[model samples]
Target: MKAKVLVTLKTGVLDPQGKAVQHALSSLGFAGVDDVRQGKLIELDLAETDPAKARDSVEAMCRALLANTVIENYSIDLVD
Candidate 1:
C-alpha cells in the first residue's frame, strides 16, 4: 500500500515563512498573489494491504511524529 499525507497549518495561525514567500512572489512581478500557506506532503510505502489498517497506521504516524497537532492538521490518502 501507499499513502500520501498532507500536513498544513490550521487557519488563523500565523505563518511567517508563507508570508515571506508571498512577499517575494509579489516583488518578482507575480501579480494577484494574495496569500500563501506552507505545508508538507509525505509519501509512505507500507506493507499492509488492508486499507483500514493502513489508514490507521498513517494517522498514527502523523499524530506521533509527522505533525504537531497543536498548530497543524493532517489528512491521509491511501493508494494501491
Candidate 2:
C-alpha cells in the first residue's frame, strides 16, 4: 500500500517561507499572483494491504511524527 500525507500550517498562522515565495514570484514577472502558501508532501510505502487499516496506520504516523498538530493540519490518502 501507498500512503500520501499533506502537511500544512493552520490558516491563521504566519508563513514566512510562503511569503518569501510570493515575493520571489512577483519579482520574476509572475504578475497577478496574489497568495502563496507552502506545505509538505510525504509518501510512504507499507506492507499492509487493507485500505482501512493502512489509513489508520498512516493517521497514527501523522499524529506521532509526520505532523505538528498544534500548528499544522494533515490530510491522508491511500492508494494501492
Question: Global lDDT for candidate 2?
Answer: 0.95
Q: What is the C-alpha lDDT of each candidate?
A: 0.95, 0.95
The C-alpha RMSD in Å for every predicted model, in order, reads: 0.6, 0.6
Model 1 residue-pair collision total = 0
lDDT by residue (tens digit), candidate 2, 16-74: 99999999999999999889999999999999999998999999999999999999999
TM-score of 2: 0.96
* C-alpha TM-score for every candidate: 0.96, 0.96
Looking at candidate 1, what is the lDDT of residue 25?
97
lDDT of 1 by residue, 1-80 (tens): 99999999999999999999999999999999889999999999999999999999998999999999999999999998
Top-lDDT structure, candidate number: 1
Backbone Cα, N, C clashes tallied per candidate? 0, 0
